[model samples]
Target: MVFKLTSVLALVAALAVTGNAQRQIQGITFAWNPDTPNGSHNLPKNALAMAPISDLNSKAFTCRTNGLNFPNIKSYSSTGGEMFIVAWDMNALNSTDGPKLNGPCNHWMASTAAGTDNLKWFRIGEVGYSAEEGWCTDKIRREGQLVVSMPNDLLPGEYIFRNEVIDLTYAGKTYTDDPTMGAQFYADCLKYTYSGGKNPKEVTTGLVSLPGAYLATDKGLLLNLTADGKPPGGKYTVPGPALHKQPNPGSA
Candidate 1:
């Protein structure tokens, strides 16, 4: 009886862990197809139980779990200046699981390379904190969506668009102090193809590579979150490269 009870308790603990780990990108509502969007057809593949990829050097930091799962490989066509609604997959009971409210949410894009390794990525949109809406994560939780705008002057080609949320709740400590006690990164990506634009030029500047774009010691990632759900000093800089400015920025 003692052994059976111990096994049951272990199982319960494992179940709780699994429930907590279900935060990931589920589907993206693209401009072309709102009904059958990016990950809607691929249910489990898009909604994987991926934990935060803390190590900046890890390849999973690029796309988290679906980095290499390019089975469908179909690109949704788009122009630019469109709003893409991204949904997070979480356990029903724990819908508001992670990507803490004090952090920033960012969007990135990379031209399709041979593989998902070492591709150059550039930030397209980001929101950290504002007196109007508070933290971006809070807005994300309230709306139950992460909205990203496609660049207005992006060159015509296939690209991998990604959405990422950096949880800075415990970023006050360095990874050197404790491996799992620093910032947490959660991201997922899908493919898109751009066609016509106002004056589209290939993104040449402000491109950064994953695993190298962010560092554990960066000023933006080392701040401590206060009880008010903001970093100390009441200032926060969104990490990653600046959004490349095009000629004519359009409406979302």
Candidate 2:
């Protein structure tokens, strides 16, 4: 689903008028079902709170609510090549009390039994700033969801997937004034079993831990979304490990 510039501008104008409020991940769908029944797959641990993690060094940066052992949350069945759609509550754009997401979108995955090794969580991909298309959050606000592709080359095993959005609307500031005057980190994870894949990578290189992945002063975090107005394109670097690539069949 693509949106035009006129429509995109309209959304930005509306969001500007409505004001900002932190929103939460409502639920996740295994496939590309935007209208899928709401609550079919359980909500994220912090769905009711609707708060963003300001401190990037805390354990909550790992999974928002649960640390390593995220138990009792409902698990879903997923196969490689399927679409994972993360649905957000309607207030993201409709109500005046929703978030104005103006930052990057990132997702990661790790083996369920990978122990405490932070390097096991490999970055899948990231969608960041675009001079012509606007921020990734713009797309999310337009559709009210963030869609990611399940890694097709991943080994068949129990895995946890995380979808995250960094709200940079106030990233250029610090907590000196208001505690909330900084970048907002919102992340959620879901457990799933994989059945089809061609790789058995347990600990891939370049993986990074969530709590240690970002810093308060990282160039990506301390950014002015308005400074780079009309661009040949802004120099917005995504903060995290490099995007994961499947190792060759028998090389690693």
Candidate 3:
């Protein structure tokens, strides 16, 4: 009886650990160099709070940078060799929302000045429902990190890198009006100063706003992943302005 009780206890402990592991995602923070002058990256005070649909245009629950200089500001090589590492936390009961079986779609963008104003931003790149992240799978999986490279000819100036992840599993709840079905939006901005570009043009053209950038009925945001047929059976269109064209540093 004693041996049987011990085995049962061990099995229970193993299951508990597995449950906890599934809740957490990896790379929710920027990977800064330890040798750099800037310290570790810090999330805004209200980073964990959820922003309502109405406040999408405004800097609703973004990092509260009141009177604070840019934290985790870093420099990047203009020759197009460097890559930015973006991460997120996805434990359901934790701060940010968890990934749905079909999604956790990602949209990354950038702007010159700092502020939550959507009008000042443009698309850099985006990743829609991905099979690598276990989209549409039966088990709970974490979509944690991404690596992004800037255009070689990117202008030299102060810029803000904005990363947005939309949880579409619970989307469509509100439908056409405010289709956020229980959808959750997670976003973070990192600051940077660039130099050494060959033909750096200002990124004022093709600007897009956050709330204005997406609609409730956008194909990528409102689709039902669990339907009997194959999930997202067509070319996935990332909602927003066209990708800005950058000159090649090598061409200069």
Candidate 4:
């Protein structure tokens, strides 16, 4: 009887640890890096709203238990530079489904980290935002007085990827919360103006990671780290540095 009791206790303890570990990953938070609209356009300086996305267990969405299992992304090149796989598959939850950005700004495609004076954006996925972090450690340069945005028609706008979402069943109550459904992405977007780089890109941080064999995907950048249940910025691999350049105004 004593041996049997000990075995039962061990099994219960193992289950408890497994359950707790699962919840730890479920609790993921995200941050928005803010910036202004244009240079003379008086764009805000490093602006962000703080989306704080927490994807708790919701039987409604029917998301993969192994977290968001994104499909293999695709990439292409055109006048718009290079459009990499922004998201695996996406479905909006509501009107603000596009960007899911911080502050009130949502619609954007490419953004820099230095500041917003040289920020540029495009349209893909939805309007606002998704889990995908736009333009990772990237470079953007602007010279002309003209505000550099997009093609002959693409305007500087921000929207969210919100559509076909349902209420999250939390604590026995259906919360009509909108979290953009799509595979996360990261971009290596670059912008250089005629004047070269009088304008600087914006820089900011987003989202918190969890412990254990971790994984992250953004456009072309992918990171696989082990937190061992540690806090943010805890010993991690140093993937090759971000894209860099020295604006050759002489080429002008």
Best by TM-score: 1
Residue 82 of model 2: what lDDT? Answer: 56
Show where candidate 4 strays beyond 4 Å: 1-47, 51-135, 138-149, 153-252
For 79-130, candidate 3 gives per-residue lDDT tens digits of: 3324444433334423234443344444344544555343367767666544
- Please write out the lDDT profile of model 4 over residues 1-252, one tens digit for every residue: 012333322322222211111111111001010111120111111111112222333321212223322221111112222111111111111123333312111112333233533332322222212223311110000100101122212212221111111111111211223344322222112222211222333323221111111122322112222222111233322221221232333221
Candidate 4, residue 244: the lDDT equals: 27
Q: How close is candidate 1 to the true structure, as a TM-score?
A: 0.78
lDDT, candidates in the order shown: 0.66, 0.63, 0.45, 0.20
Between candidates 1 and 2, name the one with more favorable TM-score: 1
lDDT of 1 by residue, 191-211 (tens): 766785667777789999887
- Candidate 2, overall lDDT? 0.63
Question: Poorest 10 consecutive residues of model 3 by lDDT?
Answer: 23-32
* Pairs of colliding residues, candidate 2: 21-98
The TM-score of predicted model 4 comes to 0.18
TM-scores, all candidates, are: 0.78, 0.74, 0.62, 0.18
Candidate 1 error regions (>4 Å): 1-21, 31-49, 70-75, 89-101, 113-116, 246-252
State the RMSD for candidate 3.
10.7
Best by lDDT: 1
Regions more than 4 Å wrong, model 3:
1-81, 90-101, 104-107, 113-119, 130-143, 173-183, 227-230, 246-252
